[model samples]
Target: MTSDTPARRRARVFSRRRSAPSRARRRLGAAVRMIAALALAGGVYTAFTPGAFAEDNVQLSAAAQEGKALFDNSCISCHGRDGQGVEERGPSLIGVGSASVEFQVSTGRMPMTRQEAQAEQKTPQFDETQTKQLAQYIQELGGGPELPEGELVEDLKTNPDALARGGELFRINCTSCHGFGGGGGALSSGKFAPSLHDATQEQIYAAMLTGPQNMPVFGDNQLTPDEKREIITYITVQLQDDRDPGGLFNLGRYGPSTEGMAIFLVGIVLLVFTSLWIAGKS
Candidate 1:
């Protein structure tokens, strides 16, 4: 009986030893599950955070809404509640695009004090932020040609053949109104093509895209991005910033028209002087 008891105790010990690894594995698995639950809870909390969700949803459409408000307050009289325009107050802006709004507002040619033949550039009623908001409103209201986004000036400087290509394109297309040197020239009525002297790259690009006032719209189809950049390079670098290298005169950068007028006047004066000299000698 004593020997049998010892054998039973040995058997019991062996069974416990065999089950120890299984118990340890179960404990480890439970710990892993608890850790996974904690991580999942944390992820859920972060995703539902008020600030994060608000920032994601609210800011995305804020600009356009604010722009709509601005349009309602100041522009409703001229542009109408639906942006359809009111007779002589304003023209329809259904498809004018954000470029037109930005150019007109940023340049302060809008929110006119009085209706005239043309809107003149003046001190802006709204700052740049407000102007952009207005542009966003106009953009959302109606779809039209959009100015290319991002840094337009940087690309013009980097392009190697910009100057050459721009010169040719400018002479062919721009000389009639802008002059050969971008000095600007007369148009019908009191309207005139503005000079490119002080115009920034953005303004120039906007002008081309929107065709403010009587200027014809040169959309992306008419002038591709590369062509527009080339034209801007020529206008800014060669025409606006030219030092007129060598001893030759620039003649106001007006090309042959002004030179021809000056030559004709000079010739007339010389002929009169020669006639007097001949009479005196005779």
Candidate 2:
């Protein structure tokens, strides 16, 4: 019979340790199995989820297809293939959606005429149908903010309450950048807040949703749908009609700065002119 001495016990322990995998090896094996199990679970979930399948199997509509064609011909230069966008040339349009495309194309801001500090509004290259098709293509490529259906305040012109509410909303939300009159104000850098005078309801809504250029996005979370409609009503009904005092005397409607300049410069010039006339008559 072998006595269980410390030497014999040490030998047995070493043998067991040798027979078993090293701690590092055991941990590596466990990690590999865990990863494989997770991968299998993910695969099953992806296969079973209807939403995942729908997103993966989506096919472009006719309008989207036509828009893709137009994009290939016209927008591909800077935006790149599949609208991935080229570095430094243009931003990726994948997630921008239809609202952004409509606002840019309809307002004739995209397909920019030479890269400047900002893309100013010009005559649109694409007409309404083409613009819609383009917007649809972008909307399908990557889902994003979309304009709600039905009227965006068609009756706002007649609704005095709506106009009043809208004016108040506009004053609170828009007065800083757009100025009190919505004639638009100069921003830092070359970018400027655009005049909202001629902007249509759709355009205004789109701008609010997308936040073109320096404009901050007024998402539904910040401003509800009805509030947007009211603001649109105010802009269309009140601001558009709020004309400047006519003639060359009005100068640019930069609010107080221009008013102050008119008071100082024009007042001094009138005084000088009246003095000369009085002296000559005497």
List per-prediction Cα lDDT, in the order shown: 0.79, 0.86
RMSD of candidate 1 to the true fold? 17.7
Q: Residue pairs in steric clash, candidate 2?
A: none
lDDT of 2 by residue, 1-282 (tens): 978999999999998898677776899999999999999999999887542211434599999999989999999999987777889898888778799999999999999968898899999999999999999988887677888888889877798999889989999999899988788888988989998988988999999999999999998899999999999988887767655523334456444567777689989999999999999999
Could you give the C-alpha RMSD of every candidate to the true structure, in order shown? 17.7, 4.2
lDDT of 1: 0.79
Tens-place lDDT per residue, model 1, 38-103, is 999999999865322212133325787888788888998998865777897888777788888888
What lDDT does candidate 1 reach at residue 52? 26
lDDT at 135 for candidate 2? 93
Q: Which has the greatest TM-score?
A: 2
Task: Please state the error at residue 85 of candidate 1 in Å.
Answer: 1.3
Question: Candidate 1 regions off by >4 Å?
Answer: 1-60, 158-160, 243-251, 256-282
Superposed by TM-score, candidate 1 places the C-alpha of residue 219 at a distance from the truth, in angstroms, of 2.1
